[model samples]
Target: MQKDKRYDQLLDRIENDRDELVELCLKLGNTPSYHAKERNVGDLVVEWFKASGIAASLQFITDESVNAVATVPGSGDGTSLILNAHMDTGPEPGPDATEADKKIDTAWTEGELIFGRGVINDKAQLCAFMIAARAIKRAGIRLRGDLTITAVAFETGAPSIDKDQGVNYPGEGFGTKWVVDRGVTADYALVGETSGFGIVRAECGAVWLKVRVKGREVYTPRLERGSSIQENPNAFAKAAHAILALEEWAVQYQKKEKLEFEGGAIVPKAQIMNVRGNDEISQASPFCDIYMDIRLVPGRKPEAVKKDVERVVRGLGFDYEISAFQYSRGHIAQNAGPLIAAIEEAHRYVFETEPPLPPSAEVSMWRDLNVFNEVGIPSICYGPPRQRDPYSGAGNRAMKISDLVAATKVYALTALLVCGVSDR
Candidate 1:
């Protein structure tokens, strides 16, 4: 593919500011922004935007959460683009978490990689978008269409369930939905997420279901133990049986509902997230509630999955009730040709090869890209790889510096290509 002279210029500018990019990423990553608490990181993001001469502001979401919206205005005749990344990191460590768990949120550099909890999941991409826009401004490139960079809060998969404190926790896509509903839209959107330098146009939507199993409450002395868990009077025992049955069903569900698309594949999965029963050990609980998260491909209704789950658990011969508390349908980008072409060109220029397909895990997981596609703005996710820890065989809380620079270059060129240049 023939490269544009302007594209070369943009890449050169990004390369020149590599140190600044790393510094910004480290600062953002080192700050804690666990869901519902993004004010500190939001402040840092806004500060960087203003320092780099980009128009930026914070859209307050809650008392402690805020979304940072920065923009480069265009001359009004070309397609606009929105570059998005979440402000929240993964769930915070529990009170009894190990030292390693506690250190996951603190960013650090080791050789070529930057490590932190949200670095690979989002902050790396967030900093990349910021640096990319800064490079565009420094290079004095005026776009014909607007370019918006958004770092939204509460994009993690945590849901709000009312307990003693009420629904204080706002769920995923909360800030993105708020910003978009209030006129932060564009003709196209590119979500910055971890995709191993691949492009993704589809993601799995999620359904949060609560399943309750009822049983006769009894004190331990008067409790009647049965040979089978189904016959046991304790709801906890029956709940255990239901959990096992659902685990078996989940294996088959993933196989049956796997969706293969041109951009990538979506594997709908099911997992039991939480289970609640009696607080007292001496008394048998009257009911046990199971919280489950079931992922679905585009066009799969929550009602249908509810029925499927009912069929499996009902077979265990127990009285149970199931309810879907939240449902968000997965989406594939429509009218995304121009955005896709721009990404392909930019990726080729940055990596010197055709962009690869996103990992199945990244493609199958939900992101703010689904929110944009849900709202009729054609959108896709493209970013660098998440490094894995060789010793632990778990996802390393880190990202490669080289990968971050490459993603930054792609983002800048993609914005320029999609938004076009003003002949000023």
Candidate 2:
């Protein structure tokens, strides 16, 4: 009964602080922390943490990028927990961005929902972590173990490709890896991402490959026709054949690499992101580059996957070179039972139902969970769902305010359970 009373106090405190949590979410969602440029948002997070009396600091990964780390120290008797979320939003709008695209950075409220780019994808959960700690502090709950909240930069899956300039775009767990390597660890980690309030134990890793196909360069007006696409002298013609082959291979690959776990299934997928070639109109290109993004299930080796890709592309009878510019292996938590039990209990206390598994699509994508599990810290991804438009079948870059409050309660309760309360 005393434990139940403590849970009530924490939930009440979180409910009373809903307005402040919403304000923080809006503030964070309004800030444009585009990938690789998250300094401003990071500073805001630091200020909020300090004002709330939590000890906080920034781990600078680059001159313009930093990971915000905040903590509520415990008395060193129970296990520690890390609640992590990315500070950076999705990619910025390009030159031809629509008005809707431009509106992604601006936060707005309608009825019970908050609309913005980062609001649902991450900013909401980031704010929830901060508010959960504050609620614990306000409820006079002295934890026996530490509760650390991290807002890392560069959790976006974009690779660090150096083209015209230097390596300007550094992503794919860059900040999370840095903080982990620098000793910001815990007994377990809960990554706050868009998981539809379900628990995700496994996630697929990814590899970005650049497949270059070589051909003879010739003037467009003087180019000779060939009997088949493979015999054509132009790289673009041969690339068509390769693309078809890849399309066929991708269907089979997804079926062969599907992985199933207790939580859900991970269907590894592949796609040709872009095809690059010469832009000069008067000449046939000498070479074409196909950039591919391939997702791999846990225990799958990247080198083996690359070899499989090479075999498929080489069979097109074209001279080619394939190289993986970026790769990270997928992982499953080896000892996540304790953490899962804590979350499940907290979730049931908050929602009065059993927690469900996230959709297969959510588990198939990459997130910072992979980073924590890679360093031997058992981790899982959990957060609220994104509101979907019924008619348009499009996901709104928004989050429900009620969902935010519920997630905050669950996070605080989970922390209380995982990091046992102290008498002091």
Candidate 3:
């Protein structure tokens, strides 16, 4: 079918409301929701949804986190559509912030880009969904299927390890899993993650592993030098060997394992993020800890990855205890589905060009879409245009203002098409 008048009308509406969309994006980006702490941002979403004439509610995931949910009912004869994104920005700079890092909390427009924490991480998606819902309402289009928007919490960082904070070692997909388990589900879910508007159907799974290497404590003088090293088992020395071995393993793994897709392939990766041993200067440390982050392509299980780590460590003849500290599975959705088709159609209509092929896996990262996919909901990530910060140390997170407008059009159009308009 050729492009329809409804698609053009929606695109025009999104373009005309560009200023409001930018304002909403700034509002969401400026509101800081650190980790499990998202009360203010969550409340803001709820308030906005209700004010826009959508049904809104807050579902508590924990004392510290809540999932803000909004819905527009359809005719009940078609598939329900879910527009999802996390409310939490990535790991906070903690309570202590240098003036520069603190500036990241404020959203500002510089030229054609909007700089802020959540703009690309997901505040942009949150606001885009809100605007899309509002456009559907403004156009007076009644969908045959229900339209639901879930602005979830903690999608940016790993699960809480702090028990006193009421979080007990949660990992990725924390909020989406909570909502799914709590009976908030849909036939199709469009995850608003930063993918430069690329449709993402697959992603790599990941796990955090902690390895402890044990050795006999010995005096410094007894530590062997050169060829004598065979007789001495210094924990620090053993850790050094283990770190090098792990690094080499990571290089080989990346070279050997790859999952190819339309645009690119995902390579499984392993890296030693941290290493620690006793601080005593006079003696060889008896134990050392190694922190490992392993990324696996979809179809590879975390258990298997754990086994691979154990195999490498055991091969080195080191007495060790390895544990999967935390883990999240990856997902692969159908290459073609109603949600994908609707999004592709929206992209073509909005950009007047063919959409890029869907990404193989969101490279190395995971999203709430993984959670929804696990629970049998067909989900994919499609959001505003963004690029990774070249300086990971200095905060320069940003996205194009034009990209936001285009994405809002795609999102609004996707919801309208997937939900199916009804005469009622």
Q: Report the C-alpha displacement of residue 149, candidate 1, in angstroms.
A: 0.5
Worst 10 residues of 1 by lDDT: 162-171
Misplaced by over 4 Å in model 1 are: 162-167, 390-394
lDDT by residue (320-351, candidate 2, tens digit) is 99999888889987899989898899999999
Local distance difference test, candidate 1: 0.87
lDDT tens per residue, model 1, 38-75: 89999999998898889899998777788999999999
Give the Å shift of residue 396 in candidate 2. Answer: 4.1
Candidate 1, residue 188: lDDT: 96
TM-score of each: 0.96, 0.95, 0.90
The TM-score leader among the candidates is 1
State in Å the error of residue 300, model 1.
0.2
Better of 2 and 3 by lDDT: 2
